[model samples]
Target chain A: MNRSILLQSRPVGMPGPENFEFREGSVQEPQEGQAVIRTLYLSVDPYMRGRMSDAKSYVEPFKLNEVISGGIVGEVVESKSGDLQPGDKVIGMLGWRLYNTVDAGSVRKLDPSIAPLSAYLSVLGLTGLTAYFGLLDIGKPKAGETVVVSGAAGSVGMFVGQIAKIQGTRVVGIAGTDEKCEYLTRELGFDAAVNYKADNFQEELAAACPNGVDVYFDNVGGSVSDAVMNLLNDYARIPLCGAISSYNSTEDVGPRILSKLIKTRSMIKGFVLSDYASRQAEGMQQLGQWLAEGKLKYEETIVEGFDHVVDAFLQLFQGTNLGKMLVKVSDPQA
Target chain B: MNRSILLQSRPVGMPGPENFEFREGSVQEPQEGQAVIRTLYLSVDPYMRGRMSDAKSYVEPFKLNEVISGGIVGEVVESKSGDLQPGDKVIGMLGWRLYNTVDAGSVRKLDPSIAPLSAYLSVLGLTGLTAYFGLLDIGKPKAGETVVVSGAAGSVGMFVGQIAKIQGTRVVGIAGTDEKCEYLTRELGFDAAVNYKADNFQEELAAACPNGVDVYFDNVGGSVSDAVMNLLNDYARIPLCGAISSYNSTEDVGPRILSKLIKTRSMIKGFVLSDYASRQAEGMQQLGQWLAEGKLKYEETIVEGFDHVVDAFLQLFQGTNLGKMLVKVSDPQA
Candidate 1:
């Protein structure tokens, strides 16, 4: 039986599990030029929060009573074209479904030996490409410069700090907890990490970036960004990837930024990963090398089951997960 | 004797003429590499408001009780260096003074036959270069795109619209009065013009930009900007040239922008003209050719005499000037 989760209703502020509804139906056979893929994992991302609202955005809003969709990895159980055979693994923007028989054109087949199946869903996928381009192309961190990243323990932020460190920059991280902070500094080789939830966050962040910030990779916006923006050096470059802090908040937030940009002669650019698709292969090659060399490390906060995919997605707004959050929905058949 | 304007006190809100104090001093003789020059024209700009305050900015605040300084056109009356001679026209950052002996290297000599002497202070100067780079480099308005300019009757905004029109784009100008709007469309050949002060400003602006705004050259940054911002197209580019609307306001005012930028995948870049010094020669060459060919037209509202410079500077906040506002310190020669 195919179990799926649908967007039961549009969310008001922070979405709850009740906004999602579950359905079960038997799997169907593949048509010509198609494959039946069994779901292996579902990636939960912060940007998905934007899709819940009906407002115009880069992507369309999820229709009520329809299946919620995003990046997914699965193993093909059957195939109907020369391009694929049974037992091949694939990844696509398939959905929160236990089984999907879709067009072969929609899914890219992945080799298990190249990397783990979930790595294709994490460091080697959207978040990894996001960090690589946003830092190197937009942020352009120079050696001996300071690079501050908010949400430094999340999927994208973690790679941003690590990549800046690789470029020989002094990295300062802002996270929600001391645990994430510790992991950033001790395990990830970051120069310093400060917990934004603490009373002394602003002071600590200032002290950590003594030379002022030259490159700021913003994953979470709001007051934390306002404080960080104060320390921007002349010609600072800000790669605004996401604003998870105010994503679920109904009220408008963020300080006056145009004046700051003018005064510091700095620049802030907003970008989505797909905008860099033409250059994605170059980014993936470098990330793959780093992962293989042990220079890049990643962690997954996993919740096991198709029944818990909605809960995992809800946890993104709560800042409850560390690193990449994923739902291991029925791992490839043993 | 030299007449000068001094900063009496830093302003609290909107600056008044009382904040300025007049002074009389003697002109010093030319030193080794210095030449004595008489101020011919003083360029009064809205950005001067920022330099009046003791707060941090791209340029240092006017030192209390010191000669207020900015872009000035002068005639060298004596020679000390081989580069400049008596009666030579030059432009430099001198002061609100009638006479001055300055380093010859500090000024760039201008040919009156190439363009008028005061034109050196207007279309062939900083405002011209600002419009060139800000629109061509930053805005990157493609052919058939809709280009919108706020403060459309001002020095820089006029050139921005004309340049976009030359690029085969539909140009829309936002000005303060019906006269300016009529001048922009009928005289300057803009596709459309909308008065920002109209009762139905937002509706008028929307109707004017039928295809939506692709490049917004913003000079005003308050409610007028917020209304314009809502009509941004996908991948829109905003060349943030000025914020004259909120420059004198005691409080911060503007819509939240990070979300807007993300929604449109747009970019806003704040830049000073000098930041493009490496490309200035290229811009100057183009602007010079345009002026010589009668492809670009410029208007100047000149307030005669050194004593009225402060009043002319104050008039910027009132939006009284049509194009470049200049204070004629003296005739080039009597």
Candidate 2:
């Protein structure tokens, strides 16, 4: 029996567990050039919040009563294709189901010998690639420059700060709690990290970035972005990766920044991972090399069982997760 | 005697004639490397509003009780340098005085046969170059795309529309009055022009660009920009040239658009003409070639006498000028 989760209804503001529904069905038999895969791990990203709302966006809105689809890693249990064996592991954008019957060509086979299979769902996958392209291509951080990232404890934000450090830039991070702030600076080697909830957050941020911000990687927008914008140096570059803060808010209003932008001759660009689809391999290789060389490190917060998938996704908005949040459904039996 | 305009006081909000004072002084004798120039034409630009306030900007603020200087065209009346001769026309950033004794090297000699002396302050000068670089280099408008420009009847905006048209793109202009709208579409050859003051302005603008805006040349940043932002296409580019609407306002508040930018993977960059200083020659050559071919046109609103200089400048905030606003101090005797 395949247990699957579906979007029961569209969310109004902050999505609740009631918006999702669980169902059980028999797994389909594999045809020629097909494989039956047992789910191992799945990713819960903040960008998925955008897909829940019925609005025009980079991706289509999730249909009501349909299975929710996202990045998933699984083991091929039943295979009829010549290219794949029954014991091979693979990754693809798949439904939130215990078992998936898909075409063999749809999933990319993963080698567990290189890195952990779960890494493909976290630092080595979409999150890492998003950070790589957004920071290097758009932010273009230089040596001795200051790079500030909002949502510093989040999946993409963590990688942004780390990669910016690799480019010889002074990295400052903004997170919700003191623990997250400490982890960003102490564990991740960030130059500084400040709690946005503090009363003197604006002053602390200004003091941390004495030279002014040259590159700002924005993950959570709204007031956090408003504060960071005030410290932008001339010719500063901002890469708008995600806006988790405004994702749940109905009204998106803030201080108008065009005047400041004109005064400093700065630039801000919004981008998604799909914009660099052709360069995915290059990003993966560099991230893998860094991980192997001990130059880069990553952390993951894993929630056990498929039953807790909806809870894990809801926790993203609560700012509780320390790093990349993932659902570990079952261990790979390959 | 040289009659000069000085900044008597800083303005609180919108500047008035009270903020300026007239003074009389004896004209200085030309030194070995200097020349005496009689002011012919002086320019009044919206960007000058930023300099009027005692705030940090691209240019220094107007110091209290000191002579205010801007783009000026004049004729040499006394020359002690070999680089300049009496009866030669020149252009430079000079004081707003009837007579200016300046180093000859500071002013560039202008040939009257190439263009009218006043043209140096309008079409063939900073205004034209600003439009040329901001649209081509940053906006990157392509053939068959729709380009929308705000303040379309103003100096730089007029040139931006024409340049976009020359690139084979459909051009739309947004202005304050119906007469200005008609002038843009009928006289300036814009594809469409919408009066932003109309109650149905948003609807009219939507009707004008059926394909959606690919490039937005923003000059006025307020509710007008908020309206145009809603209709951006995927990968749209916005060149933040001016924010005339917010220049005098104490507080700048508006609807946030980062969500929309992420949705479209668009980019917005703020820039001044000084950023393109190295490429100024290239832009001037192109604009001059276009003007000689009868493919470009310019309009000037000249206020006679130095006494109306402050009035002409204040009129810019009222949106009364059709194009470049200049104060005609005197006719060149060269």
Candidate 3:
């Protein structure tokens, strides 16, 4: 038996559990050039909120009453392809189900020796690559320049801060909790971390970057972004990655920033990981090198069981997860 | 006696006549390497509003009780330098006074035979160069793409629309009045023109750009910009030149556009003409060629007399100028 989560209905503002449905069905046998993989881990991201809507975006919207799909890591249970065999660990954009019977070509085989299989779904996957291209290619932080990252406790933001630090920049982070703020400075070695939920957020953010912001990696856009915008230096570059703050709000109104941008002669560019698809290998190799050298570190909050997938996804909006948020469906055979 | 206007006080919101004070004084004698220039035409621009307030910006704020300086075309009345002679036409960033005695190198000599002295302060000058760089460098409007420019009847906007047309792109103009709209489409060769003040502005804008906006040259950045932003195509480029709509308003608030930008993977860059100083000659040469070829045309709403400089500058906010606004201080010696 296979249990799969489906988009029950479209969300209006903030999505709730009622918008999703879990259906049980019989597992299918693998066809030629196909592999039946048992799900190990499935990644949930803030950007996924955009996919739930029917609007035209970078990625296609998920169909109603159909199986919802995202980044999933699995172990091959049965294989009809010559390349994939039982016990082989692979990762692909597969459905949220206990068993995913997909074409062997669709999934990339992962070696557990280099790093744990779960790491591929987090630090070494789209999340880390998002941070890599957005920060280096767009933000282009120079040494001794100030780099500010919003959602600095999240997966992409964490990597952005670390990579900026590696580039010899003064890294300032904006998060929601004091605990996350401490973790960013103490664990991630961010030069400064300010809690956005604090009453004195504006004052704290201004104080964090004494030299003014040269590069701003925006994940959560709103008043938080407005504050950072005021501190932009001449020729500042902003890589607009995600607007998690406005994801659930129907009316995302704020102070117009074009005047401020003109005053500083700055640039703000929006991008996604797919924009750098041709440079995937380059990003992965660099991120892996950084991980091996102890220059980069990552954390993941894994929820147990496929039944808790929706709960895990919902928790992302609440800012409960420290880093990458994933759900463990089953353990790989030893 | 030389007449000059001084910044009497900084404006709180919209500037009034009381903010300026006119005074009379004797003209200074020319020193070594200096030439006394009789002011012919002085430019009144929207960007001057920013200088009126004591805000730290790309240009310094106007000093209280000091002469407000800007782009001025004048005639040399007396010279102490071999480079300049009496009756030679020149242009420079000079004080708003009848006679300015300054260093010869401070002003660039202009030949009246090449083009009218007043043209040097309009089409063949900074206004035209601003449109050239902002449209080509940042906007990057390609042939067959749709280019939309706000404030399309203004000095820079007129050049922008015409240049986009020259690039073989479909040009759309957004302006305040129907007369301006007609002038843009009929007189300036714009493919389409929509009055932003019309009741069904959004509908009209959508109808105007069937292919969607590929390049948006934003000059008025408030609700009018919000309308155009919704019609952006993938990889759209926005060259933010000004925010005239919000220039006087204390709170420049509107819908947040980072989410829309992310959906299209677009870029919005705020730039001043000075950013492309190295390529000034190239821009000027191209503009001159276009004007010579009759592909580009310009208009100046010259308010005669130095006393009306304040009124002319204030009229910019009212959207009264058809193109560049200039104060005709005195006619060049025939």
Candidate 4:
């Protein structure tokens, strides 16, 4: 029996676990040119929150009684296609289900010997690709330039800070708690980290970045973004990866320092990882090399059951996850 | 004797004639390394409106009891420095005064034989330089692309359309009156012109731009900019030269389509002509060549006297001037 969570209702503010309903169903036999995979690790992202609402956005909202789809790393249990063999591991945009039967072309074979299979859902996956393109393409960090990133403890933010450091630029991160801030500076090798929950967040951000921010990788918008914008240097670049702060807001509350963009001749560009789909292979190769060099570190807060997928997703909004939030649907077969 | 209007008080909205007080004073002789020039044409631009207020902006606000300075075209009457001789036409940043003394290095010698002396204050001056850099550098219009400009009949907007046309792109303009719109399309060779006052502005704008706007030279930032922003194609560039629409606003009201920038990967860059000071000579040489070739046509709405300079400046906010607004401080010395 395969278990899947279906969208039962649309969410208004933060989505509750009740919005999704788990149902058990029989796994069908794979057709020709298709492979059946048992889910191992399912990725949860902040953008999915936008997809849960019925509002108009870049992607369509999840339909009622349909399985929500995102990135997944799983092992091939059976294959009707010549490209894959039974027990082979692969990664692709697979939905939240215990088992999935998808077209062979939709999946890419993963090398488990190079790294752990779950690494495909973190450092070598969409999270790493997003940080690479968003920083290099949009942020355009130069050597000696100061880079500031919000949500520094999260999946994308962690990679963004480390990438800037690799580019020989000063990296300052803004996280929610003292522990996450410490983790960012100590484990991730960020130059400085500030706790946004601190009473003097703005002052701390300023003191940390005395030279002013040249590139701001904005993951969380609202007050945090507003503070960073005030500290932007002239001709600064902002790659707006996400605005998790305002994603749940029912009313539209746009960023306040929009006028500062004019005065400083700065730019704020929104990016989607899918937009760089053509360059995915190039990005992954570089990210994989960095991981192999031990230059990049990744952490995943895994929730241990298939039924707790909704709980893992909801934790993203509350800032409960330390790094990439993943749902470990099942243990790897030995 | 020379007469000059000095700033008296900052007005809330439009500066009435009362806000300026003219003082008749004797013209002082040029000291060592100084030259005396008789002002022929004085520019009245929307930016000067900002200088009249106490608010902080890119440029310093005009202080009370100080002379309001801007671009001026004049003929040297006396030279204390060997760099300039009597009867030499010059262009420089001089105020509303009919006659004044300035250092020789501060002025650029103009060849009146190449084009009219007033041309130095209009097409070959700061107005033309602004359009050149704002459109070409920031807007980055490619051949066959659709370029749109607001305040089309104004100084900067006129050059923006002509330069876009030179790049083999389709050009559209937005102006206030039917006469200005006619001039933009017929004389200036714009493909289309929209009268912002027309009831069917949105519809006319859409019909005029069938290919979608690729570059929007934003001179007026208000509802007009908002309308054009909505019709922008993906990767559109907006050269934010001026926001005359909000220059007089008592309350803070900016462009409404800010979020659209994120969706389309568009860029809105605010530029002050002075910021590109090092490249001013390069811009002038190109603009002068275009004017001499008759490829660029410029018009000036010259107000009769220095006393009406305040009225002429106020007319800019009201959209009364058809092209580059100027104050004829004195008759040319034959």
Candidate 5:
């Protein structure tokens, strides 16, 4: 039986367990040149929240009563195609189901020895690619310059700060909790980490970035972004990633400080992962090298079981997870 | 005697007559390597408003009880330097007064035969150079792309539209009045024009830009900018020149739809002319050629008396000026 999570309803302000429905169904037998895969892991991201609303966006909204689909890593249990075998580990844009009978070309095989299989959804994958292209292409951090990242402990933010650090920048991180702030400064070697939840978030941030912000990789928006924007130096570059702060808000968010952009002669650019599809290879090659050299490190907050997929996604908004948030669907056939 | 205007007080919200105090003073005789010039024309620009406030900005704030300075075209009245002679026309950063004893190297001689003396303060000068670099370097409008210029009938906007037209792109202009809109499409050769002050501004703009905006030259900010931002196409580029709309506002202007930048992969870059100072020669060369070819056109709202200089400067915020707003201080030698 294939257990799949369906978009039972559209969320109004914030999405919850009620917005999704779990369905049990039989898996289809693979046709010629087809493969059946058992889910191994599911990657939840902040961008997926954008896909839940029926608004004008880059990607289409998830239809009501239909299966929710996202980045998934799985193992092939049945294969008719000669290119893939029954025991190969694969990753693709697959359904959040126990089993999937996909076209052989829909999934690509991953070797476990090349970092962990989960890294395909993380450091060497979409999250890593987002950080690489956004920072290098837009942010363009220089050595000795101060680089600030909002949502510093999130999947994309963690990578953005590290990449800027690797470029020899003074990285100041902004996160929600004290532990996340500590992890960023103590473990990740960030120049400084300010807790956004702290009463003196703005003052702490200002003190941390005494030289003023040169490159700001924004993963969270609203007032937090506005506060960071106030400290931007002349010719600062802002790479707009995700406005996680206002995604699920029922009320109107306040105005962004746009005059700052003009006053400082700065630049703010917004882009998605798909925008750099052609340049993925260029990004992956560099990210892979950094991982092999032990120059980059990552942490994942894994929520066990397929039933908890919805909870894992909600955890993103709640700020319960640090680094990449994933649901371990199943263990591979060792 | 030199007539001067001093910033008597920093404006609380919108500046009025009281903020300026008129004064009369005597000029010193020219020293060696010095030249005294009679002010011919004074260029009043939107950016001047920024300098009036004591905020953290690229340029310094206007000091109390000192003559306000800006672009001035003049005739050399007394010269102790060989480079400048009496009756020679020149332009440079000069005081808002009848006479200025400036360093000989500070003022560059202008040939009236190439362009009218005031043209050095408008089309063939900083205004023209601003349009050239901002449109070509940052906006980068390609042929067949739809380029839109806000403040379309102003000095810089008129040149921006014309330059985009020369590039074979469809040009659309946005202004405050019907006359300005008509001038943009008729005299400036813009493909379409919309009056932002109209009751159905959004509808008018939507109709004018049917192809979606590919390049946006933003001079006016606030709600007007937000309306235009919504119509941006994929990979659109915005050259943010000025924010005249919100300069006088005491309260918060509405938020910029920054997510639009991300969804469409657009970029908004703010720049001051000094940032392109090194490339001024390149810009002027192109603008001069365009002017010589009769391909570029400009209009001037000339305030005849030095007493009305304050009125002319105030007209900028009121949207009364059609093109370059200049106060004619004196006439070039006839």
Candidate 6:
């Protein structure tokens, strides 16, 4: 028997852990061209909160009785296909479950020796690719220009600040806590970090970025985005990655200072990681090289057990997790 | 002596006639490198509303007690510069004055025989250039796509819809009245037009544009912009030209559909005509060619007398003007 969590109902505000219900079911045998994966880790991202809502969105909402799905890393327990064998590690979009029986073509084998398997869900996965495309493709940061990123201590934001630094741009970050701010500045190599919770957030931001922001990588949109909008230079670019601040709110209060977008001759574009799915391999190659060179650093906040999956997700809205939040679904070699 | 209207005070909302003080002043003789001009026409655009306020914007706010400046067409009464001669028709950014002295390099001498002198202040002037860059450069419309332009009966908006139609795109327009809607569709060759005053605006917009909007030329940016935002297709582009709706509001209430921007992956870019000043000549050439070929049409709402300039500007926000609103500053040369 395998265990998985299913969406119980849609949420209006911040979803409680009760919105999901854990259930046990018999594991199906791998059919032809199929492989069975023993769930190792499950990613918990803010974007997943949108999937739990019934509202119209880029992707379909999670059905009431279906398993909520996202990126997962696991080990192949059994194989009915010639392409895979037992003891193979792979990473793909598998849901919250102890075991998954999916087509072999859906999984990409991960060489555990090359990098830690968890990294496939972090720096070398959707997190890294999202930062790569959003900042470079949309933001278009130029050398000597200043780049500002919100949620800087989180997985994608951390990579965004570092990548902007690598391109010879001054990078400023906004995080939630003092500890995260220190980590972003000291370890992630951001030029400066502002704790958004501080009383003088707007002042600190202005002092840190005197040249005015040229590219703003928006992850936590709300007041933080509004403050940044005022400091944007003419013809600035904004890459909308996530709006974690509003994701939990029952009522939709759109980002303030949208009029500034017109006054400054700036651009605001929304992007989903899936939109760049076709060019992911190209992203992976460059990300892999950056990882090998130690030019990119990654961190993960891992919860101990499968039962804590819902708890891990809830932590994202409360700003409790640092970097990518993940649930250890089962023993690595189970 | 020549008559001119000077900015008496920076306005808080709509500028009343009292805000402009008409004064009589002597026209000075042209010094070396200067040309003395007798003004023929003056352009009154929605952007001038922003200049009337003291708020910081893309361009500098108009200084109190100075002449409100914009595009002007005139004839050189006398010249002390090599580039211009007496009776030469010229176009430039002169103010609300009947007669003025300008450096020869500041004005472009127009050949009145090729086109009417007022044409320099309309189709061959900044209004034409603004439409060209807003549509082609910013919107980047593809052939066979659908374009929706707000304030479609107005100066730049009319050109935007017509230009999109010229590129073989289905163009839909939103006007303030049934008469304006009829003029847009029947006279301007737009595929469809919707009178925004209709009770079922949303349904009418949907009916007018059966295909989703590919490019949105936003001029009236309030509820009208919100309605358009809801219908934007994936990868849709919005060239933000003007926001006439919010120009008169005392309180800050922005567009309510900003969340749609994220869901549809749409991009909204604010643009000022002066931002593309380096390429103004190219835009003027292209627009002039279209006008001369009779493929492009333009209308001018001529308000006579320099003293009534403020009235002409106020008419813009009321949605009363049908096309390019201009002030006839002086009698046309016989």
**Chain A accuracy as TM-score for every candidate:** 0.98, 0.99, 0.99, 0.97, 0.98, 0.97
* Residue A141 alpha-carbon offset, candidate 3, angstroms: 0.4
* Superior by TM-score: candidate 4 or candidate 5: 5
Model 6 lDDT per residue over A1-334, tens place: 9988999988888899779999999898989999999999889888888899887778788999899898999998999999888888889888788899999999999988778888999889989999999999999999999999999988899999999999999999999999999999998899999999899999999999999999999998778887888799999999988888777775555443445777788998888888898999899999999989999889999998888889988998888778888888776663
Question: In candidate 6, which residue pairs clash?
Answer: none
Worst 10 residues of 3 chain B by lDDT: B111-120
True contacts kept of 4: 0.26
lDDT (tens digit, per residue) of candidate 2 on B1-334: 8899999988888999999999999999989999999999999999988887988777789888999999999999999999998999999999999999999999998989988778888888989999999999999999999999999999999999999999999999999999999999999999999999999888999999999999999999999999998999999999999999999899989888888888888999999999899998898889989999998899999999998999999999999998899999998775
Model 5 ranges with Cα > 4 A deviation: none
B237-324, model 3: which lDDT tens digit per residue?
A: 9999999887788888899999999989999999999999999999988998998899998988989998899999999999989999
Task: Provide the overall lDDT of each model, using Cα atoms, as 2-decimal numbers.
Answer: 0.88, 0.93, 0.94, 0.86, 0.89, 0.86
Candidate numbers, best TM-score first, in rank order: 3, 2, 5, 1, 6, 4
Ranking of models by lDDT = 3, 2, 5, 1, 6, 4
Alpha-carbon runs more than 4 Å astray in model 6 = A254-258, B255-258
Best by lDDT: 3
If scored against the real structure, what TM-score would every candidate get? 0.96, 0.99, 0.99, 0.87, 0.97, 0.95
Give each model's clash number. 0, 0, 0, 0, 0, 0
* 1 against 4, candidate with superior DockQ: 1
CA deviation > 4 Å runs, candidate 4:
A5-24, A49-66, A168-170, A177-179, A182-209, A253-258, A274-282, A289-294, B5-28, B31-33, B49-66, B143-145, B166-172, B176-212, B246-259, B274-295
The residue pairs found clashing in candidate 4 are none
The iRMS of model 6 comes to: 2.5
Q: Per-residue alpha-carbon lDDT of model 6 for B1-334, expressed as tens digits?
A: 9877788987776678778888888997788999988888888888887888887688788888887788898888888999998888888888778888999999998887777778777677777778889999989999999999999999888899889988999999999999999999899999999988889998999887788889999888777877787788877899988888777776555443445666677888998888888998898888878888888999989999877787888788888888899888887563
**For candidate 5, lDDT tens digit of each residue in A162-194?**
999999999999999999999999988899999
Candidate 4 C-alpha error for residue B23, in Å: 4.4
